[model samples]
Target: MELPKGLAGVVVDQTKVSSTKNAVLTYAGYPIKELKDAPFEEVVFLLWHTRLPSADELSEFRKRLVSEMVLPEKTVQLITRITYEPQHPMSILRTTVSLLGTTNDVKRDDPPRILAKLLTAIAAIIRIRDGQPIKHAQKGWGVVENFIYLFSGQRPTPERVAMFNTVMVLHADHEFNASTFTARVVASTQADYYSCLTAAVCALKGPLHGGANERVFKMLETIRDTGQDPVQYVKDQMASGHKIMGFGHRIYKNGDPRAVILREVARKIAHETDNDSYFVLQEQIKDYMFKATHLHPNVDYYTALIYHCFDLDKQTFTMMFAACRTAGWLAHIVEQQAEGCLIRPSSEYVGETNRHYPSR
Candidate 1:
């Protein structure tokens, strides 16, 4: 029997967290188009519980998440020391997640607290690398608002908050992507939350996964700095047999729904931040790619510009991905652990299987 490589299209397990069936992304069966404008915390609650939170439940959930968005002083001191090592923020984040498990009361930490800590930790990594003191979460602010404040050290306008909230909501989950599956594989071993998250971060650090956003921004910078014609840039890149960084997806042959919504967010934020030129360059490339290859932009395409408009360095982009995705990772970890089954799979030996070992 011929098996699909990378387990593509194989249903290894069932999930209620999110889905991409028919190329439409949904959280607990609610389409992302409707949920993207919903509060980020509400979307998180939906991912975790498979239902949207009631009014009081959402309010309390928001408060709890904000309140827990603080790190232990010892953790902060340790993070400050190592975050300036000239390492990628994603590398720092990978270590910080494992450190979090050891430094805190890991056993008692629930998903709310774990998610809050990761968001705060990712924000702190960016701030410390930039030589800025970390900011505390403000009372009465929502999760996305306080997250922006923590990293940027400024209160975002309500409009900015709404836009970023959509970014977070859109990235909160995808059913059984590589990193989520890595988390679930680890969780099937009954590992702690941080371990599963750390494994997920490692998987996300690869160029093909979360790291694609940074490369997308790098391509934009190359084109803008050289003043190259945008369409020519695509032609030249493909002529050299290089894959375009942000075009195409494994599942969505038509287009990524998240990219459709994020295109507007990126447009608005880019205009606000005087980054309209980059956005223009993106449109040229997007149009050319579609006409040339029938490949549309995925979520990573516009999100690069969106993060740039927020004043984030390209290196920390995947860390931002991790922050939003921790919600989904935690949800999957819980679900996988509840099944209480170890994820062991059989494989046909593809190498020379009959070779006998020589006596040493």
Candidate 2:
């Protein structure tokens, strides 16, 4: 039998959490565009339950999530040490997620608490690395508001919060993406949530997956700082055999729907933050890329600019991706556990199959 390399276009299993069917993303049967403007908590609830939450249920769910955002004292202490290790933020995050499983009562934690802690832990990693004191989640603020405040150490305007809410919702899940599939593989073994999340983080650390956004920003910075023409820089890089970081995607041949939404957000925030030059450069590069290669930007394209507008360091960009994606990871973990099947698959051995034993 012939098998596709890397399991490309293979349907290994079924999931109810999300889908990329027809190149449109949906979470639990709701199209992403319809849910884009919904509260992040409502989307999270819907992903977990496969149904929208009632108003009262959403309120409680939001409150519960915010309340659980605090880390245990020991975890905070450990994170401080981990953050200052001069490692990549994603590396620090990989260790930190594993640390969470150790420092907390992993066996007793559920999805809501785990998701909340993941958010808080990610925010804390940013602050600690910057030598800023960690901020506590405010009691009455919603999850997005509190998450922004925790990392940024200031209250965000409603418009900014709304933009980020869309970011979180858009990233919440992509059915059987690399990291989510890694998470599900671990979950199929009935590992705890943190273990599944840790494996997912490792998968996402790869450049072909969640790490693309940081590289995208790095490319922007190189072009901006060096006074190189953006178009010329891309041309030179392509000539040198370097892959452009943020263009094209496997699933969305025409364009990424999330990129379309985030392009607007990136434009608004770029103008607001006086980063319009980068935005303009992006548009030029985007247009030129499409004309030259018919390749369109994916979700990471505008998100790099959006994070820069938020005053985040480029290295921390993928960690932000991990934070948004933790909700989806938890949702998938739960779903895989419910199905209770081992995810082991057989591989075809073609390497000197019958000759190896003779010499030994």
Q: Global lDDT of each model?
A: 0.94, 0.93
CA RMSD of all predictions: 1.0, 1.2
lDDT per residue as tens, model 2, 1-360: 989878878999998999999999999999999999899999999999999999999999999999999999999999998777569999999999999999988777999999999999999999999899999999989999999999999999999999999999999999999999999999999998989999999999988899999999999888999999999999998899987888988889999999999999999999999999999989989998998889999999999999999999999999999999998999999999999999999888877755545665
Residue 309 of model 1, lDDT score: 96
* Residue 222 C-alpha lDDT in model 1: 98
How far residue 182's Cα lies from its native spot in candidate 1, in Å, is 0.3
lDDT against true structure, model 2: 0.93
Q: Which stretches of candidate 2 lie over 4 Å from their true place?
A: 356-360
